[model samples]
Target: MHRSLLAGTFLLLFTTAASLAAAGSSTGLDDEIEGESRPAPSSQIPLPQEGDKPEAENGEPPEGNVTRPDTREETPIPDVLYDISALPEPVQRMRKLLMDAARSGDIENLRPLIGTGANRTQMALGGLEGDPIEFLREISGDDEGQEILAILLEVLEAGFVHLDEGTERELYVWPYFFSVPLEELTPAQKVELFKLVTAGDYEEMRTFGAYIFYRTAITPDGEWLFFVAGD
Candidate 1:
C-alpha cells in the first residue's frame, strides 16, 4: 500500500510538471506569433498630403509618376536613292555608243557626228575621251559646262572608282579602259595611279590634276594609236 501511494504521488508530480512545461511553450509561441503579426514601424508611417509635402530636389516628377507609354512617335526613313535614269532614245543611244566606243576604243558611234562638222567632230570626239568635263562640253557648253566640270573634277579628286568588268558591254566599258594597264605600271606607279584616280577631300576625280590620264599615247605600232584618256 505504501509503495503504491508513493508511485501515484510521483506520477501526479510528473504530469503537473509536463502540463506546466507545455503551457510555457504555448505562451512563448503565442508571444512570438503576436510579435511577428505586429505592423513594421516604417509601414505604419503615414504619407504626407500633396500640399504639405516638400518640393522635389530635382524639380522632377516622383518615381511613382514616371512611366513609359505603350506607343511613341517614330521618324520617317527615306528609301534608297538612285540617280535619274537616262532614258531618252537619243541620249540613251549616245550614252550607249559613247560607252561602247570608250571600252573598245572604237569610234563607230561617232560616224553620224563626223558628218556634222569639224566643231561637232571635235566636241563629239572629246566625248569619246573619258573626260566627263569634255563630255559636258559636248552635251552642254558655257556656264553649265563650267559648273559640271567643277563638279566632275571634285568627284574625281576624292572618289575611288570601282569598275566592274563583266560580260555586260556597257558596264564593262568602265573596267575595260578606266584603269591604267598593269604591264605599263610598276607597284609604286599603280599606287600613284590609284591616288590620282581617287584624289581629294571630295568624291569624283574632277580636279585639275586628272588631265595626265586623259592625254594621248602613241603606241609603238604606227598603225594603232591608243588614247591615254580613258586608261
Candidate 2:
C-alpha cells in the first residue's frame, strides 16, 4: 500500500509540470502574433525656415522670389503761357527778332541775333564746326532751311513758360512743353502740341520719358541760350 501511494504522488507531480509548460508556450505565440500585426510609427519631415529661398533649376534664385523696381520718374508740370506781352522788355525784343528773322524766310537774317564770341546762340549741343546757316540748311527737310524757319515760327507762336523766376538762370522756353510733363498735358494742351509734332512723334517722346524735340531757351537778359534737340 505504501509503494502504491508513492507511484500515485510521482504521476500527479509529472502531470502538473506538463500543464505549466503548455501554458507558457501558448502565451509566447500570442505575444509574437500581436507584434507582427501592429502598425509602425511614421518618420517626420522638417519645414523650411523663414527667409529661406528655393533655388531654381539653374541654381539661381527663383524668378518669382525677386522684386523689380519702377525706374520712371515723376515730374511737376509748370504753367503754360500764350501771350508774351506780359514778359520782360528784353525777352519781348528777343522774341520779336527771332520771329522777324523766321518770317523773312532768310536763314542769314538770324546771323546777327545769333551773336558772336562766348554768348553765341547754341545751335548744337556739342557746338557748331562749320557755317551755322549752312548747318541749318542741312538739318532742314527741304535742304533750303525753309523747314527750319517754319519750325522756328511755330515754336515762337506756341505757349511758353517762364522758369527759374528771380534767379540768374531764369529762362523763357518755347512751347511750354519743355517744362511740363507729357503725362500731365490736358486735351487742349495736347492740341497745342499737335501743332508742333505728329501723333507718332508724341508717342515716341512718351516712350522716351520726356520730350526730346527741338526746343528754344532764352535767358532773362534776351540772350538766346540754346536752340537744339535731345535730352
Candidate 3:
C-alpha cells in the first residue's frame, strides 16, 4: 500500500471551559477550533495523477462486493467516511463499540478489547504513545477528551480511501487538509477539505508544518490498533 506523505504531528492545545462531563457532548462553540478560512499555500505534498489511481477513488466501492445490507446502493461516497458495511458483520459490530468507547472516553471499556497486534498508541495526538486508555486520559484530562476522541472516530469511520485489507489489521486513509501540504491543493479544494474536518487551527501550522489525516488501523474483529495522523 502507498503511504500518504501528509503524516503530521499535532501539539494538542486544549483549553476548555469544562471537563468532558457527558458521554455525548459537543466541544461547545467557544471551545471549538475556529476555521474561518484555509491555511496559507505553504505545505506541499503532491497528489497522485488522475489515471494511474486505484479503481476505488473516493466515489464508490468496487462491485461484486455489494451484496451486503449496508452497501451504498446508489449513494455518493463521502469524502471522509468509508462504507464500512463492506466489512464483515463482526468487524462492523466491533468498530462501532470501539468508536463508542472513544466517543465516551471510557478507556476501561476499550482496554479489554484491544488487540495484541497493535500495542503502540502512537497514532493520534502527536505522541501520547502508550496504552490507548492512558493516551486518552493524558490528552483529555476530562470530558474535553471527547472532542479528540470524536475527531478520531469521525476520521476512522469516514476515511475516503480503503488503503488495503490485511490478515489481522485493516487500514483506512483520508485527505486531511492539515496532512496535505496546503500549497498543493487548489485554493478552493483546501477550503472544501477544511470544511469537512469540522474545524482546525491551521493558521498556527503554516510554514513547514503539515496537517494530516488519521490512518486508522483496525482488526477484522474490531480492535483499534493505531489511529495516527499522517502527512
TM-score of 2: 0.66
lDDT of 1 by residue, 1-231 (tens): 122222222222112222222332222211111111211001011112243211132211122210111112352211211121422344334434433443443333334422221112221111122332223332222323332232223222221221222311111111111333334435654444443333231122233212223221111111111111210
* Cα TM-score per model: 0.21, 0.66, 0.46
> In model 2, where do residues sit more than 4 Å from their true spots?
1-76
Q: After superposition, how far is residue 115 of candidate 2 from its true place, in Å?
A: 0.9
> What lDDT does the true structure give each of the candidates?
0.24, 0.56, 0.38
Top candidate, metric lDDT: 2
- Candidate 3 lDDT, 1-231, residue by residue in tens: 011111122333222222211211222211122222111111111221232211133312223211111223454332344477786677577667767887776556766655432232223222122344544433432433454465555554543444324522233433334223556656666565554332343554454354433344444554454443323
lDDT of 3: 0.38
After superposing candidate 1, which stretches have Cα over 4 Å from the reference? 1-87, 123-231
Of 2 and 3, the candidate ahead on lDDT is 2
Global fold similarity of model 3 (TM-score):
0.46
Candidate 1 vs. true structure, TM-score: 0.21
Off by over 4 Å in 3: 1-81, 117-131, 141-144, 165-170, 174-200, 203-210, 213-215, 219-221
Best by TM-score: 2
lDDT of 2 by residue, 139-216 (tens): 454546676777778888889888757854466888688777789899998988777776766777798776555577
Q: Which is superior by lDDT, 1 or 3?
A: 3
